[model samples]
Target: MPMRPPFFALSATLVLLLSIPAQACTLWAAAGPDAGGGTLLSKNRDWAPDHVQILKYERPFGGHVFFGLYAEGNNDPGIKNGINEKGLSIVSASASSIPKKMRAHQPGKRGVIRTILSRYASVDELAADADRVFSGARANFYLVSDRSKVLLAEVGLDGKFSYRVVDKGVQTHTNHYLDPKLAEFNVSIGQSSSTRQARINELLTQSPRPFTTEKFAAISRDRNDGPDNSLWRNGKQHTVASWIVHSPASGPQKLRVVLANPDQPEALHEYTLDEAFWKKN
Candidate 1:
């Protein structure tokens, strides 16, 4: 009979496997000339196969109107990401590097995404008040963008946050911490996060300058590393949806969405940023 593994080895393996976060997402944004004139924000939302995702149009009282993506059955404060009528867009990925103890003091965990979308009109405005706006929010890395700029904010649960704003080039984030202040807390559980991060960087570097909406969509659908660690995941927990927002310099913005639920056929939806589009959505 084949020899069995030692109990200690098995235990260690189990612990390591358990530490890997189930919610994995890949996020990135491009702005300025490289983006072909405006900004491009993309995300591949991955989660358990059982959770169905949906799109929602919400207009808050005395706030901007927007459309967000959410998991089915969880409405309020459940916005995974969205774009506002003002042309500002935001997307996020889990920052699992921050320990649970650090995330215990979340004060505005609920509806924070919705609140930001409703209130902030541009990358500059959001960056200017990011500290107050994200106070006590749960740990997560958010990529916020508009026609002229892109901002990446790393919000901690203890009311501390850091952000980087860029008018040109690309900014990317995975589940790990990228900010220097938060780097010390980097406890990236599995190779999946790092692998996906590197894959994105590689693809973006090799891609030609002046990226288009089609290029962004192709990147979101990449499966180079395989089912478990590719940009487009297809393992136990897979990419349920992909989002790409293009905010042009002199025209209406466009949103391209692809839903890939395991139980249903993949669907593609597009939207234009305009009064009529907002009203119908």
Candidate 2:
């Protein structure tokens, strides 16, 4: 059995898993010099109970801020994706079983990603800071993007992580490790990740033109054409909510999003990340 940390000392990351009973999720992003034009990111948050909400935050540093939606009590505020005042956006996908190795204690229980969002001003800084929090006990994937680019940092099972500048068009991650360097430690890579990855490829390939926020949302909602590869799952492990997050390359540079609870698709809520992050007097 997995060893459970004491309640008082439980990391926010650990509490998130225990509190929500969340199973899995799918995160997709597109950016970089080669990305269609600007940035388009999306994700399907597959978890239990389906109780989700959007949250905005302000940093004490005066101008720092960010916004995201997650299960009410989740420590990782950016459950689907979030954008900071600097226009850096982040999204994470849960990779299956990885070799576990505990690391030294770190401050703050808001999970490493939330901590990164609160401190870093750009994608470059986010990646560097995340690199410093490698506990090696978890294998997860994170896609961080700015107006001009996106990067993938796969937190591996080796107390280290790997980075890959996402290619043109779209960058995607399901519930498994895609990098070959750490395949030996991938004992529990989920089967759904491959199915979803293939479906995303087909959808992007069939897109008539470069993706805009609308096109990106369409892909995120894709349920797959064939019987074999379905992107949205409603079985034992299912999609609780779906998110389409986009930040305009220019203008206020605010993060825009369309979030839909699987149980209530037509009731999808659309809001700007700025609205969620800024506080009223």
* Counted clashes in each candidate structure: 0, 2
Across residues 193-240, which tens digit of lDDT does each residue of candidate 2 receive? 667777777777777665766777667666663322356666655665
lDDT of 1 at 173: 85
Please, what's the RMSD in Å of model 2? Answer: 7.1
TM-score of each: 0.89, 0.74
Give per-residue CA lDDT, model 1, range 1-281, as digits (tens). 68535323445444464464557899988999989889999999988777677888998999999998978753213789899989989998877664444344465563367878999998888888877777646778889999999998887544667888999999998888777776654644468888999999999999999998899899988999999899998886699899999999978999999998667999999988777988874
Best by lDDT: 1
CA lDDT of each candidate? 0.82, 0.59
Instruction: Estimate the lDDT of model 1.
Output: 0.82
Clashes of 2: 2
**What is the Cα-based lDDT of residue 220 in candidate 1?**
89
